[model samples]
Target chain A: MDLLLEIAQQVINGLVIGGIYTLMALGMTMIFGILDQTNFAHGELYMLGAYAAFFFSMVLGIPYLVSVCLAILVGVLLGLMYEWLIFRPVRGKDPLNAVIASLGASIFIWNAALLVFGGAPREIPTPFLGEKVNLLGVSLNVQRLLALAVTIGIILALYWWIGKSRLGRAMRATAQNREVAALMGIKIGRVAELVFATGGALAALGGALVGPIFLLQPSMGLLAVGKAFIVVIVGGMGSVLGAIYTGFGLGVLESLTVGFLSSAYRDVISFAILILVLWVRPQGLFGRTGERGG
Target chain B: MKTLPYRNLWKWVGTGLLLLIVPVLVRDPYYLHLINMSGLSILLAASLNLITGFLGELNLGHAAFYGVGAYASALLTMRLHLPFLLTLPVASLLAAFSGALIAYPCLRLKGPYFAIATFGYGEIVRLILHNWDTLTNGPLGLRGIPGPAGFINSKVEYYYFILTIVALSLLAIWRLLHSQLGRTFWAVRQDSVVLAEMIGINSTRVKVLAFMVAAYFAGVAGSLYAHYLRFISPDTFSFLESSTALAMVIVGGLGTFWGPVLGAILFTWLPELLRSVSEYRMIFYGLLLWGSITFLPQGISGFLESRIRKNCTTGVARDAHS
Candidate 1:
């Protein structure tokens, strides 16, 4: 009965963390779908977001919600800068150029963060602090619970916005075909900028949400984005819905792995999923076949 | 006309003499180490050029193949007590075999998908090396690895030894590029779907062989690094190393024979040169990478060759669509 409860507790814990991964993966899916360039600097963006929230909340004494919004705003601006500076020129010239550039951008940003932050991790002072609330048998942190609630709320808001907003419609058209969208007077460049910003916002929100849980560090982006990449790939390249569900699935799978197997097997499982999905089933679980961007 | 031939021959001999005499000229241990590392970098970048530049596959997991070679060589040396000379070929073959297996599945995917798969594989290899304590000694790293025996024990000798390997590998690669098989690689790169198949190129086999050849040299690099450093760890073969190697190839110029050498030199020497201002060093490195890829995508060699050759290049057509 104790073992079963532990497993159940782990499941709930996994779902909470999964909420963060889902938010980040949505940004990745959006950026990749619209830009056709995998923003390898995404993890850095997440790190920046966390730092932004930490600065706003802890240093400036701003409210948690307001700081989170600041993080999102910062992320969107950074995304626009990345698009203008890195993604725009190398968009169609060479397939590998954009990817390599992104890698450089990642290294640059991570190191810059290191230079600025000085490598020591800072803890965000959230409203809930470390206070835990017991639910049945499982004890959960109030901060984590609030973060999870915010994640679900934002995701729902995103879905509605995508469905209803004019900008969302324009983004959809751009994703389908950039040149044709331009031909149809959709302003592909503006759509790209918007998509980058939206992706950045999502990633920032995820980072800010998890800032209190995981201490703000320059390298925090590396593990988060790496896992998110696996989720995005496993969910299929261009499928946002697939990324969300796979994000949760991976989190649960990881928690279960820790519960049943060993923590060492975590990397083994993620890579295995990445390899198997890509090699055996490149179409992915939910992605449609015959569409591959660059 | 006869004197012109002799002059070119003399030029070759002069350059050869200079290369041979570099160790003697630079007796400083650190400089010797830099030269030695530069050779390994050349070997790595050249090997990658075969796949990414010549073969048109963006393999981001090269360090894994390199790690495999290093571990395979280190373990074999420790267990079997084989000479380092013999271990070189053995390590190369082992890496090649693994390369063939990876390439089989890896070649099925296109572009970014292929890059991700390879990156994933590299991480898996590194993770295994980090976790499998019994074999790899885990994160503690394998210590007390012996260098080559006899007169080659000296750092200068070791540098020359690695240089010899680099020379041979470069020669082999150059010869391969000049052969019919090289033409087949060109065909495969140009259009693997139609022209490659239509030309009886056996595109898949060619690609796998290119990858194997690349891995073979990468193994050579690994084995040398293992014996040189005399310590092996999973951290040595991280994604950062792979990207740095690829960056060397890119900065050197992709699809050019001499490009990797130029790139290898820059990659090895630049960081060492910038070690004084360590804080701002990576920023500079990153900017260089970003700038090179964005502006001079063809790289230094490409820029030079384009200026000299003036649109008369063979193999890949620049701006195939436009």
Candidate 2:
């Protein structure tokens, strides 16, 4: 009985963190899927979102809810800048060039943040801080619950739009073949803009949601981006449903490892799993073979 | 027959002499230390270029081999009391073995996936070093590592020691790059694996060989660094270090023989030049990486090579007109 309760509690915790991973992975997979480029600086967008939220709510005295929206807005602008400045220039070239450029941007932003914000970790206070709800003999905090709810809502809306909307179909087409889609009258630039903006907004939302829960540090995005990459790969790059499922699954697995084993083994275990997965299925579980460039 | 470029040979000889006299010319211990560090960085960048610049596969775990080499060499000297010469080869071989272990599983992955896997592998290696307290001493790292003394005690002598090793390694790399195996590496990078396979080339074997050789050279550099600095830590071999090495290769000119050498020296000194506003150093470094990669994709060495070619062509045209 005790073990069951413990497992349940761990699962709840895992789901919350998993939601954050899914949000970040959603953005990453979309960019890779449509633009055929990897954003090594994707984490910076998440980091910036957290900083922007902290600035708006804590420093500027804006409400937390409104700050989240504003942070997403900031993410949209940054995403557009990334497309124009980094990804656009390296388009159709060696895929690795884009990776290197984004990596440079990541390093630049991370260091700039360090100089500006200092190395000290910052926390954003929220009304949901200590509130809790009891279910199945387990207590869960309001802030985490709120994050989970927002994550689910965003995922659902994104799913519906991508599945049913015309623009989403255009995105899928572009992902299939960029040249063919462009020749068929799909505006590649507009699609790219939309994809990047969406990616940025999603990643920012993740940072904003998780800010009140965990202390916002400059290096948080680095670790977060690492986990998101694992999720994107395991879910198969460019597969939305794959990312959604794998994100939560990995979260639960990690929470269980931490709960049952030790915190130190969390990264080791996840990375080992990644290597194993790649060894068995190089294209990822949900990824189609030869669907994209190596 | 490929005729040797005699003019370039003279230029190399002149540069070699200058490098040999650097310690005497710059008597300041601080400058010599920077030069030695540059030698080690060049070694690292050159080895990494084998896999990244030549093989066209981004191995984010290059630093793992470096960390392994450093720890192995340091441990051999500290615990086993082995001589510097013996430990260097043994430790580097250990690192090479680890490279093979990773490459065997990872060679099938292409492009970004390959990079991601290597990144994961690198983190795993670092985590092991961080957690395996008994072997690695955990995050505190190993200190008081012995230097290559007895024969080479002074800092100046150590500079010569590193210079000799670096020069030999570069010569070996240059020779390998011009060999048949090196040509195979270039073919694998320039063409798809399917195409290469159709021509009866085992692309996987070629990649693994490149990875092993690269790891071996990185190990040599790491062993040198472990002895010189007299400190060993997991932090030194983090993802940032790997990226810095990659930056050296890219900023120098990928796949170019002399590019990483120039880049290593420039990067080594750039930080010292920015010591006044050290806080802004990384920001500047990041800006340089982005700007260079975006604006000057071919890198500085490639740019210079192009300029020289243009001038030569124009010189010919002017002479013909006359």
Candidate 3:
């Protein structure tokens, strides 16, 4: 019974982390679904958001929530620039070229961050610093709770936007088949822009929420990108719902593994799951076979 | 065509002679070490090209093989007192095994999925290297790996040794490209499902073969690197390292034999030359990669070929290589 309670507690902790993963993966999936290219640098966009928010809160003394909005704005603008500067020119070339370009963008962002921000970790000034919430005898940090709440809010808003709005429907249509959607008079380029910006926005939100939880650093995006890739794969390539579910699943699994198993193998666990899921069920739990995803 | 063969042979001979005389001319240990690093970079990049260029898979986990080879050989030579020469083959074999392990699940996926899967596999290798402290010494790294047979006694000697490895690996790739397997690789790359199946070529087997061969040389590069540097660590082969290797291939020109070689040399030298301004180095490197891909899609060698021939026929020739 005690062990069960411990496991449950660990699970709640996992949920908090999972929420962040869900946001990051959602953004990545949106861009990948529309662009048919993986932004290896998506995490860098996330990183940019974190640094931007960090600067805003630390230097300008902006509130945490307001800093998050600033992070989203930065994310959207950077994402637009990435589309214009990186993916736009390589658009119609071999998809592999885009991959390389994304890699270059990733390196540029990562190294540029390293150069500008330095290697040291920076603390994101959070309003919830040293605040804790007691939930079922488990002490949860208030920052974690706020982060989770923000994630849920973003997911709900995204669902509404995707479900109700005309642009959202158009984005979904574009995702289903870019050529057909274009043929149907959808502005493919505009849709691409919207998706990229939204992707960036989501990633920024994730980064802002996470900055307060984990100390900020230039390389923070690398691990987030890796884990986001895993969640996307396990959740099925372009399925937003799948990404959310798998994100949470991976988070819980990671927490349980760290709690019961060796902490050292936690990363290995994700990689192993990636390989296993590919071998056993490449389509993922919710994915349709032969779907149009890379 | 008649003069082409003669000119190419002379060019090869000239380059070979140049490589031979460089050590004697520039006796500086730092330059020699840099040159050796270039040779290893060439090997790693070219090996990556075997998959991305020929096999047409955007695998993101190439550093896994390189790191595996380094750790595997480093352990053997340092712990068991095995000859460095022997450990090279053993380490490569270990890398090949891991390559084979990673390939089966990943080969089924296309495009970005393949890239991410390989990337994940790479992270798994790095994780093992980080956590498995007893064998890898964890983050502290293995030190004092002796050079090959003690004949590689100095930086120049080690430079020559690595140069030999790079040359042989290039020769192997060249030969492979001219063989039936090379054609099969192109066929698979063109369209894995239809043409390969029509020709009764197992696309999976061909991809795995390319991966194995690539892993072999990457391991060999890792082995040489470990012996030369006399140190090994998990951080040495990060995801960033894998991205760098991919950049070298892309910047050098994918699918061309000489492109990655030139790219490796230039990239290795460029960053080293910027050692004083190290902070801005990566930003420059990243911009270079972006600019090259955007401006020169076919890469430096490809551009040169087009300039000389006044046509893109060489690209076609590369595709239809015998």
DockQ of all models, two decimals each? 0.73, 0.80, 0.74
- TM-score leader: 2
- CAPRI classification of candidate 1: medium
- Output per-candidate TM-scores for chain A, rounded to 2 decimals: 0.95, 0.97, 0.95
Clashes found in each candidate (C-alpha, N, C closer than 3 A): 0, 0, 0
| Cα lDDT over the full model 3 | 0.84
Q: lDDT by residue for model 2 over A1-294, one digit each (tens)?
A: 999999999998899999999999999999998788988888988999999999999999999999999999999999999999989999998888888898889989999999888899999989998899888778889999999999999999999988889999999889889999999999999999998899899999999999999999888888888999999898898888888999999999999999999999999998998999889987777888756311
Clashing pairs in 2: none
For candidate 3 chain B, the 10 contiguous residues with the lowest summed lDDT are B313-322
**Predicted complex 2: DockQ:** 0.80
Report the number of the highest-lDDT candidate: 2
Give the range where candidate 1 chain A is weakest over 10 consecutive residues by summed lDDT. A285-294
Prediction 2: B-chain TM-score: 0.94
Residue B139 in candidate 1 has what lDDT? Answer: 95
| Model 3 iRMSD vs. native | 1.3
lDDT scores in order: 0.84, 0.88, 0.84
Worst 10 residues of 2 chain A by lDDT: A285-294
Which candidate comes out best when scored by DockQ? 2
Candidate 3: segments with Cα more than 4 A from true spot: A1-5, A292-294, B1-7, B190-193, B311-322
